[model samples]
Structures are given as C-alpha cells and as structure tokens.
Target: MMNGIEAVIFDLDGSLVDSMWIWKDIDIDYLGRFGLEPPPDLSREIEGKSFSETAAYFKERFSLPDSVEQIKADWNRMAWDKYMNEVPLKDGVGEYLDWCLSKNIRLGIATSNSRELVNSIARVHGLEHVFQCIMTSCDVGRGKPAPDIYLAVAGQLGIPPRACLVFEDIIPGILAGKAAGMKVCAVEDAYSLEQAEEKKALADYYISHFSEVLQG
Candidate 1:
C-alpha cells in the first residue's frame, strides 16, 4: 500500500484508536440530561460530522436547550476520563507507526474529533511529536465525505494528494480520502463491522489490523 506513498493520513477515533465504543454511551447520557433519548438513527445521521457540526445537529434535532458549545463541553467532560483510561491504540498500531517512522514516511491525522481530545490522546500515547500535521474537520469548510480535511492535512504535510495514503474506518471517511485523490485503506472497527462489505468495496485496501499493512 505504501508503494508510492510519501505520507499516511489516519482518521482518529476508530481508525487509529479503539475509541468508537465510547460515543454511543456519551450520546445516551448527554441527551438524558434533557430527558431525551437519542434517535434510532442518530449515529448514522451524524456519521462523519465534525465535532461542532454534531453538536449543532444535537441542538437542532433534539430541540436541546443547551447551546452548541455547551453540548460540546458536556460531551468533552463526559468523554475525557474514558478516553484517558479506557481507549487504546488499535492492534499493532505502535509497531506500524515505528516502522513508518523508520522508513521516513510522513504521518498526519485528519479527524472529525475535537482538537482537545485529539491532543489529549496524542499526549497520553506519547504521540505528540509523531505526527507532522494533526488537523480536525473543524478547520475546514466541510467534514468527511467532502475531502476538505483530508486535503488540508496533505497540504500541511507538503505531500501531493495522490501521494498520500489514508486509513479510515467508516464509509464517509473512506469516501473523503478517495475524494481527496488519495489511496484509501478501510480499517475494520467493531462499531462499523456491519458495513464491512461496503467498506471493502469502497477502499483501495482493507485490513483488520495495522499488522496486515506491515505484511505487505
């Protein structure tokens, strides 16, 4: 997959870390504060939206009394502990990162997660200095499926889009990387396992673990 790749970009939550499981619980608890339950399709409806966009969506869809910032703050507060204590890098991720570094391949992140949380993860994982560029979709005009954030990361890395390879865990994210004109690898995540076939079809490559990439 790295044949002509000068850089590798990753989506943060599910693609790079095993943290997708926390969001559903957070959504339930956050909405519970307003005596509301998340809609059945809530996750699907908000898939790939930036943190701010998701907050706005919650505010509008649930008729939430809290301002968008307030909702985000609540989520951040709820998620902080879980991320710090429960989340972990995906299987073989540490080795993969080291290998990439040894090969002098650039690394970057293009994510829909909040910057505060992303930074916290990097610091806790001792990856604060590993990535050449770390960016959130909030920095761009649009989120995943639009290619804006992916393109932004590539631009910051000084790598051409075609020379960058992206690892993503969701359909929208895979679409975003492809739309950016980069090769995309679909990563398996328990949260999105239901879409496995579609993911495999959409991405240029698919892997259940980062170790699979190393095998190539």
Candidate 2:
C-alpha cells in the first residue's frame, strides 16, 4: 500500500485512535443536561460534520441555549478526561508509525475533531513530534466528504494529493480522501461496523487492523 505513497494522513478518531466509543456517551450526557435524548439517527446526521458544524447542529437541533462556541467547549470539557485516560492507539498503529518513520514517509493528521482534543491526544501519546503536520476541518472551509481538509494536509506536507494515503473509518472520510485524489484505506471501527461492506466498496483498501498494512 505504500508503493508510491509519500505521506500518510490519518483521521484522528476511529482511524488512528480508538476514540469513537467516547462520543455516544458524551452526547447522551450532554443532552441529558437539557432533559433531551439524541435521536437514533443523530450520529448518521453528523457523521462528517466539522467540530464547529456539529456544535451548530446541536444548538439548532436541540434548541440549545448555548452559543456554538459554548457547545463546542462543553463537548471538549466532557470528553477531555476520557481522551487522556481511555483512548488508545489502534492495533498495530505503534508499529506502523515506527515503520513509516523508518521509511522517511511524511506523516500528517487531517481530522474533524477539535484542535484542543487532537493536540491533547498528541501530547498525551508523546506524538507531538511524530506527525509533520496536523490539521482540523475547522481550519479548512469544509469537513469530510468535501475533500478540503485532506487536500489541505497534503499541501501542508508538501506532498501531492495522489502521493498521500489516507486512513479513515467512515464513509464520508473515505469519500473525502478519494475526492482529494488520494488512496484511501478503510479502517474497521465498532462505531462504524455496520457499514463495513459499503466502506470496503468505496475505499481502495480495507483493513481491520493497522498490522494488515505492515503484512502487505
């Protein structure tokens, strides 16, 4: 998979880190403050939205009293401790990162998550220097399924779009990478397990663990 790849860009949640499981509980607890429960399709609706966009969505959808920025802050506060203590690198990710470093492959992060949390993850994992570039959808004009963030990361890494390989765990993310003219590898995550077949169809490759890439 690294054949002609110059850079590897990873989506933060679910892709590089096993953090997708934290969100549903956060949503439940956050909305519980208002005595509201998330609709069953809430995750689907916000699948590819940027952090700012998701905050705005909650404000409008739930008739929230907080501003968009406040909503985002609340989420960051709610998820902070969990991210630091609970989230972990996906299987074989450590080895894969080492391999990439050994090959002198440029590494980057293109995520839809908040910068605060992403930075926190990097610092906690001692990955502050691991990636050459880290970008958020909030910094770009649009979020996943739009290709803006992915393209931006590739540009920042000074690598061509086609030379960057993206690891993603959701359909919108896979679509975004493809739209950016990069090869996308669909990652398996319990949060998106139901869409496994579709992800496989959309991505150039699919793997349940990062170890699969090393084996190939």
Indicate the TM-score of model 1: 0.99
lDDT of 1 at 175: 97
131-165: candidate 2 lDDT, tens digit per residue? 99999999995888999999999999999998999
Q: How badly does each model clash, as a count of residue pairs? A: 0, 0
Which residue pairs does candidate 2 place in steric collision? Answer: none
**Candidate 2 Cα deviation (angstroms), residue 54:** 0.2
- Strongest candidate by lDDT: 2
Q: What TM-score fits each model?
A: 0.99, 0.99
Candidate 2 lDDT (Cα, 0 to 1) = 0.96
lDDT per residue as tens, model 1, 96-153? 9999899999999999999999999999999989999999999895888999999999
